[model samples]
Target: MDDAIQTEPVRQKKQKTAAGGSKAGTAERRGTDVTRVSEVSLSSKRAATAPIAVLLAAAVLLAGCWDSREVNELAVVMAAAIDQADEQNIELSVQVYNPRTAGGGGQVGQMSGGSGGGAGAFVVRSAVGSTMADAMSKLQEKLPRQIFWGHGEVFVIGEAVASKGLREHMDFLLRSPEIRDKADVFIVKGKAKPLLTLPVPLEGNTAQTMGKLADIHLGVQVSIINLTRMLAGSARGAILPLVQLSQSEEKAGDSGKIPFMTGAGVLKNDKLIGYIDVATMRGAMWVRDEIELATVTVTPTRTERGDVTVRLVRSRTKLVPRIEDGKWAITVESEAQGDILQNTTNVDFGNPLLAGRLEQDFNDQIERRMTGAIEKLQKMNADVLGFSQAFHRRYPKEWNKVKDRWDEQFPHVQATAVVKVKIERHGLSSSGAVRPNDEVQAE
Candidate 1:
């Protein structure tokens, strides 16, 4: 019985050991399977996450639609015209661009296409309201696309609008971010819209043609920035190139019928006071130091008989203001270089002595003409010459005393002008086929 009991205990120990080994093996195998399953799940998760990451990145890129504007969605303004519709209403006219004509040529694959229509590149739209902004907004409602002023090249203000005071109306132009300050500004004699309606010749648009003409032949091409500067200055007066429709029927032939710059409109405190002809504008140019190209015809009292047209190559003017004995005097000194363009009378062309005599005659003529203009401005009491500013710079104390009464005192002020001109370069072949009467006698 004792032997049987010991054998039973040994058997029980064996059974316990076998069960423990089986349980350990099963747990180890289960752990391996769990790890394999986790690995497979992780790989699947990574595959799914890759596409989500790409999609999220694309979403971030696609989110920025804040300021996006398609080319066709904008109504590009090429020029603007401002006029006074009535006592309390302001008229705004815009020349809007057509994108069909503005787009690049050709089809999807090719790079070429038919040229756009030239005349319809610009479309006119106008509105009337109490203020400039109001007028613009009213016009905007009629436009199918958003108005864009970035490309605007011209701004024309009518005489009625300018004469009434443009400072208030022009505030929008100064304040707008899209409106370029470099755009050229002109003052039209009649309604501003009429100037824009004129047919353009070689150029695509009337605004561009006017801009080119203003730079080349007009009095002075005053940009929006220039106009602002002049208006903001202490002088509080300015001048703008005036454009008038040409009356010549022949001008309507090859070159499309269009208006040309005829004179300058004088503005006092942002209001059009009057117009100055081309001759007077030359004098104003001297005061402003802006003479680019000019021709002077002077009849020299000589051993000769006709007049000579001297074409000026370069010209400059200096202003000197003096205050003494409770009175003001301004001295204008101008110097110029010219060439004899037309010789109506035969004179010694090669002689240096004759050239000196011609130079003296040209100088006298310029002085007389410039002096007359200075006298006229002095009588008009226009400080367009900036004499008041010069006085302020040189004699500050005197300026402080008389600055208030400058307008009243300017008309009576005395002005002296001295002009000196030099004739450089007689054209090639000094003595042409035409001989002088004296030279003929000698022959």
Candidate 2:
């Protein structure tokens, strides 16, 4: 009877253990199935939402047209002129483009009607106010379209205005987002309007023609960027290419009745001090290392007769400042490579020996001309050559000590010039085709 009871309990315990194992396995399987279904549902939801997100992005982009600007609605200004009207007011003149005339066909006759009764291709609008912003606003009221400055070519400041002080006037140009700092800056000898009114020749506009003339005819091309750099440099003085209304009959009968570059205007701390002619301006170019295309006529020595015009193909200048015995001296070294463009007399230009002599003679002449210019500038007490800046660069400590007295030290400063010229070619005409003093026969 005891054995039967013990066997019965063991059988009951085995059955309970089997039932618990099956229940635990079922529960684990159900948990894994639930996790897989949740992952599938999340993926389906993301797939459903993607298209709506893309559509919303497209809607935002289509709604915001904040930066849209039409070209026709903007009245493009090709050039601007600023002048002083009075002690309390400033005058602003803008050369606005006439698209009607500009967009006309290439044939000159087709654009004739849009020339505004022979007033030329552009319209000049002037306004006077207390500040540049105010002056520009006043001018805007007269225009039917908004003023656009992206295509501006030149900025002119009248002598009167420049004399007063350009530091304040220039701030508007420098800070404005529309006006380009690359536009050429000029100091007009008189009123700036006369320059804008002058007839344009090949370029169809006065500013374009003048800008080209500044690049080709004259060497002094002072852009707004150049002016800013000059102002920032230790050399506070700046020189701007000067343009004036040429009333000469000779000029009027010439190409397109366009006015010419007169000279260079000297500026002392942003104020017009005086004017220097083309010759002196060339000297300034040598000191400033700005010579691009220069033709030097050198009178030959006893070894060669007649004149040889050396056309400078490439030129460079270096200013070396040194202090000795508590005195400052600047050495101006100019190295130039050129070719004989015109040779009046037969001098063996092909021969290296003869070329050397010609080169020396050319160098001497350049040195003399450059030296004379430096002397003139020194006498005027002008630091247009940036000698003071050189001093500052070489001896910063010493320059600071003498910064206030640079004007006093400049007049007495000694300048030495060294010029080296190399003649590379003699052009297509290797020898003089026509004999000296021989008249050419008409073909």
Q: How close is candidate 1 to the true structure, as a TM-score?
A: 0.77
User: In model 1, what lDDT does residue 363 have?
Assistant: 76
The sequence of per-residue lDDT tens digits that candidate 2 reaches over residues 113-147 is 21133333567778899999999999888788898
> Which number leads on lDDT?
2
The estimated TM-scores of all candidates read: 0.77, 0.81
Q: Number of the top candidate by TM-score?
A: 2
Candidate 1 worst ten-residue window by lDDT: 107-116
CA lDDT, every model vs. true structure? 0.76, 0.79
TM-score of 2: 0.81
Ten contiguous residues minimizing lDDT sum, candidate 2: 107-116
Model 1 accuracy (lDDT, Cα): 0.76
lDDT of 1 at 170: 66
Q: How well does candidate 2 score on lDDT at residue 22?
A: 90
